[model samples]
Target: MSLNEWFERGISKEEYIDSLQKHRDNFLHIYENFSVPTSDSLSNKENIRTIVLAEEWCGHCMLNIPILLRLTEQANIPIRFLPRDENLELMDQYTVDGKRYIPIVIFIDQEGNEVAKWGPMAPEVKELVEKLKVNVPTKDSPDYEGAFRQYVKEIVDVFRHDAAYWNYVYEDMIKSLP
Candidate 1:
C-alpha cells in the first residue's frame, strides 16, 4: 500500500492518545504545555501533512508525539498516527542502521510525495540518552537486565520532566519540515 493508504488506515489523534496503555499523562503534559515557536516558514505551506509512526509504550513517543501533535495543530498541518509494530512494513522504510525506530514523522505534500522527515530523537536528546546508557551494566553481567530496566525508567523520567529536551525536539522537527 502507498503511504497515503497507510496514513488513511492510521488512527486519529484522539483515538491514538486515548488508547495509550502507558505514558498517557506524559503525552498529555507535552501536548498541553508545548508552545510551537512562531515559524514564518510553515505559514504558507498549506498542503503539508504528517504521518507519525509511533507506539504508545515507546518512551520517545511519549515525549515526542505530543510535541508533534501540538506543533501540527498550531501549524494547521494534518497528521495521522500509525502504530509502529503493526505498520512495520511501512516503518521499515524509515529505519536507521537497519533498526526500526518509533516516532518517525514523515512530511508529505498534497501529491503524496515525501518532502522531509524527522524522528526517533533530536541529536542533543540522543546524546543525553547515550550518556545515561553508559551507566547500564554489560549484557554479560548478571545484573544486566535489572540495570537496563532501571535505565529505561531513568530515561522516561528525563523525557517526562525536561523542557530543554522538548525544545530540542521542536527545533529539530521544525528544521526538517518543508
Candidate 2:
C-alpha cells in the first residue's frame, strides 16, 4: 500500500514508537535530538513528497525514522510510511546494497517524478554498524547474544551522548535536495 493508505490504516508515528518495545529508550534519545524548528523555510523549497518504508521493530528504523518524521513535519512536507516487509515492490526499488533495508525513504517531485532516496542509517552510524557487525561474535559462540547486545548498547550510547554526530545526519539528509 502507498503511504496514504498506510496512514489511513492507522499505522501512525505514535503507534510505531510504542511498537519499538525494548528499543524505545534508544529511540527516545534520538528523537530528542531531532529538533524541529517553529518555522522551517525549507518546507516545499523543492516541492518534494516523501515515502518512508520502515518497520517499527527494526533497530535502525527506530533510530532514523523518528528523525525523518521530525524534519518532514517541521518542513511541512507531507510524509507517509509503508511497512518494508509488506511492500516488497517499493522496497526492492530502493534497497540498500541490493538488499531490502528498513527506513528507505523515497522522495518524489510535484510532477510525480522520483527525486532522491535515503535510508537504513546515517552515514557514520552505518560505518559503525559495519565494523561492529564484523567484530561481534555469531550464534556459534557460547556467549554470542550477550556480546552482540553489548555492542548494540554501545552504539545506542553513542547516539545518546554524541549529539553533534547525529545533527550532521539530520543536516546531510535535509541538504540532499537537488
Candidate 3:
C-alpha cells in the first residue's frame, strides 16, 4: 500500500492533525526548554539532510511517521520523502547493502556522509503498539514519561542491533529525499 493509503487506513487527516497536536502538547509539557535541532545544528556546519523512505502499508511507519513530522515541524528542519518502489535508481544508490525495508529515516551530513539511520523491526512494531496503548493518556491514567522512554529504547535498539539494515535503509532514504 502507498503512504496515502496507509494514512487513510490508520487515521483520517483530521485525526492525524489532532494526534500531532496532542503529541506536540505532550512534548512541550515535558520539554518546555527543548528546542528542535536545526538542520545546521544537525550537520554542525555541514550540509545535513534527511530522507524518509516509507510505504503507506507499514504499521511501524504509521506509528513513527507522525512523530517525525512533528519533530521536523518543531525543529524547522527540511525533509524529503520518496516512495520505496518509485525511486528504484535512487534506491540502488543508497540501499542498505541490498536489503529493502520500509520506513527508513536517514540523516546525511554535508559531505554526503551518513550520520545515522533508523527504522523499525518487523517484530518490534506490535510490541511498541501494545506498550503505547498501555500508556496512552486518558482521564483516569496518564504516564507518558514511561511510555516515551520505552518508545525511545525500542527505537534505539533497532539502530544498535540492526546495523546493516538500518544503514542500508538510511542510505536509501537519504538519497531519495529532497
Candidate 4:
C-alpha cells in the first residue's frame, strides 16, 4: 500500500542496480558514440539548490527519489531532502495549489528564489522525454551545446514527472554516488 511496500514488492536493491547499470551503460554508449549535445551552454546560468519534499513511505517518493539522486550525480547538483509530513512548515514553501505532493521538487536559484517547481503529474517515458525535448534546439543546430543543456534539464524534469522513471534513475544514481 505504501511506497516502501511497493518497492519491496517490485524491486530489490540488486534488481534495481542491475537495471540502472543497463541504463547507465546505454546512456554512456549513446553519450560517447553519438553526437548528442552536452549541457554546458544553457541560458539558465544560475546554480540551483533542490529541496525535495517527500516521505519514504510514499510510492511516488520511493520511485522519484532514485532518479533525483541520479540527476544530482550527473549534474553535480546539490539537494536537500525533507520529509513532507514531518516538515509541514517547510513544505508549505513549495506547495502547488495548496496541496503538498510527495516528491515535490523545488528549484531555488543562488539568490534562494524559487525559479521553477514541478510534480504531481505522472507521465510515461515517451511523454516525459518529449517534454524535455521541447524548446531545445536540434542536434543539427549550431547551438548544440545549448540544446544539450536543455536535454539535461529535461532529464531532470522527467524525474519529477513520475515514479517508474524516477526509480530507474534513482537506482543508477545510488550506485554511482560516493
Each prediction's TM-score against the native? 0.94, 0.80, 0.41, 0.45
Number of residue pairs clashing in candidate 2, backbone atoms closer than 3 angstroms, sequence gap of 3 or more or interchain: 0
What is the per-residue lDDT of model 3 for residues 80-121, given as tens digits with 9 covering 90 to 100?
666667755545555655777666766665555556665643
lDDT of 1 at 84: 88
- For candidate 2, lDDT tens digit of each residue in 1-178? 5534433443556666666776677788788766855454674544877777887677777667767877777776767676788878767777767888777877776665667777666778878788877868778998888888888777777766777656656766776755
Q: Is candidate 1 or candidate 4 better by TM-score?
A: 1
Best by TM-score: 1
In order, the Cα lDDT scores of the candidates are 0.86, 0.71, 0.49, 0.51
> Deviation in angstroms for 67 in model 3?
0.6
- With a 3 Å backbone cut-off (N, CA, C), the pairs that clash in candidate 4 are 66-170, 67-170
The ten-residue window of minimal lDDT in model 1 covers 37-46
Pairing residues by index, what is the TM-score of model 4? Answer: 0.45
Which residues of candidate 4, in runs, are more than 4 Å off? 1-46, 125-178
lDDT (Cα, tens digit) per residue for candidate 4, span 58-165 = 544544555555565456555666557766776676677788866676666666666655564445543665666776787788988888776865564444443456
> How do these models rank on TM-score, best leading?
1, 2, 4, 3
Question: In model 2, what are the clashing residue pairs, if there are any?
Answer: none
Better of 1 and 4 by lDDT: 1
